[model samples]
Target: MNSSFPRLVEAVTLCFMSLNESCPRTVYTLALRGPLYLLFAVIVILIVIGNLLVICIIIFSQHLHTSTNFLVLSLSVAGLLLGVVVMPFSMVRSLETCWYFGKVFCNFHSTVDIILCNTTVWHLTFISIDRYLAVCHPMEYQKQMTNRLCVAMIMSSWSLSSVFGFTITLLDPEIKRKETFHMNCFGGCFALHTKEIGVQYSIIFYFIPVSIIVTVYSRIFFVAVRQSKLIHSYNYNPKAPLKSKGFKATKTLAVVIGTFLVCWTPFFMCNIIDPIIDHSVPPLLYEVFMWLAYLNTMFNPIIYSFFYRWFRETSKNFWERLLNILI
Candidate 1:
């Protein structure tokens, strides 16, 4: 009776184990435990919480809500969504061999992955333009980027990105969608862009945006460096303050743009090239590149904390206040 009772308890515990806990052994050399999963978990947490902290600081600190900083806040919000909505699904799809989230969710997840990522890119470009106006045309910067206009620009950015991403991707005919992206059998769920679809999206999302980012930042760097030289060479002057401040702001944004490019370029390259190469890239390699792109969302706040002095100060104060309330 004692032995039978122990066995009955063990059987009940096995039946109640999580779906994830019941994964069968595989021949794939995957580490779903220990260091690998831990690292992925950390990345997701930092991306979500770091972006959230940025949003909180921006919301609470009225001074930080300038036209340019508003653009930064928009990007951070996109990053927050990327981490909260996109990364967890990607992580599960990467770790597990099955797709239990249903077909409707598969479409929703794929669409959102594209939407949030596209929005982040637009915010980066607009932020660069804002910095440019501040550095190159201070008098006009105030006149041009009014608070109402900034709000309008933010709305336009989101609307344009969604319209572009969703419109282009969903325009593929019914048969094509089934052939490429559909998850049919409760098995692995990953968005596989067909060669035609890949080429179309790469041009729309990648090539054109890369051209804009490069062109804008190239001019920003030249103007910022030239102004920084003048500021350093002179004694205290009235114009010196504005020039120095604008140059510092440009520098901070330049780092942010550079980091975004570095983190996302690999995925962009692989994504475009994979279709051209008949999707010859190994699944694991593709997954690595994709996660590397997601890591940009994580790196955004780290870049801000490192380079942006106002953000650092505000963050410090925000944390202190929260700690005091908790204590």
Candidate 2:
């Protein structure tokens, strides 16, 4: 065995200092700490500000307020919480490899991670269902997706995710002790699941939601295509851009769903497979996939700003106001 392995592990306990008296005599060198912290800082800033902007746009733009936009706002809220609650600390842990935070915090943090990520997935599912109704059953969409219904869906998503997350943490000791010190290094946390738990989480939370999203979007696109054909066949040029805008919204959401599913698959696959292989996976690879999943949250608001008309208009107005204030 290479003698350097232990040092490498020890060195990972970088810049994060805690009051743990029994902490190993391992700290990341000055050279490594700077770049790592810089990287995390940029990521934290991006996710926070971008998602905040998304929330602001959805909330303040009255014209944008609808069942669909509210569902989007709910999803934005989850992404915001994930960024604010999970990302900064996770960045520290991923780099430091030491759980300087105490036992209680370890459990709380891991539970938050599980709950919020799962909630985001559920939010996406709700969004897909909403879009399906809007496009596939346009006449009934408004009645079916009332404000009360949207609120119920959001509440249900969070409630189910919380129950599932807390239950997993309670039943699975591995998750409860996710952040801790390794024998060779300090703060070695593994949120690795058992085979049964892994399978359940991957299938129930990730795979099922993804399938719903894909299926719903397929149906939505079919309706959109049919609508477009009808418009062309009749040469019916409507005065308002509402119908064309609706189709564009469907296209934009399709992009969103596609991007999310693409980013989500690898993480779920790893979650399912890693523990079944008794966690023989490389830490570097695991970290890569986890961060890649993190990027989904980061990308969502950016995607909306690029593709969603309301988001762009609201963001433009927001920036203009800020600039006026500065001036």
Which pairs clash in model 2? 97-187, 98-186, 98-187, 99-187, 180-188, 181-187
What is candidate 2's lDDT per residue for 195-293, written digit by digit as tens?
Answer: 778888888898888878888888888788778767666765555343554578688887888778777888889888877676666666777788888
Task: Tell me the whole-model lDDT of each prediction, alpha carbons only.
Answer: 0.73, 0.77
Question: Highest lDDT: which candidate?
Answer: 2
The parts of candidate 2 lying over 4 Å away from their true place are 1-33, 175-186, 236-243, 322-327
lDDT of 1 at 214: 82
lDDT: worst 10-residue window of model 2: 176-185
Clash pairs, candidate 1, are none
- For candidate 1, lDDT tens digit of each residue in 129-238? 77777778877888998999888878977998788667644663223434333223334445535666667666766677778878887887788778777866776565
**In candidate 1, where is summed lDDT lowest over 10 consecutive residues?**
7-16
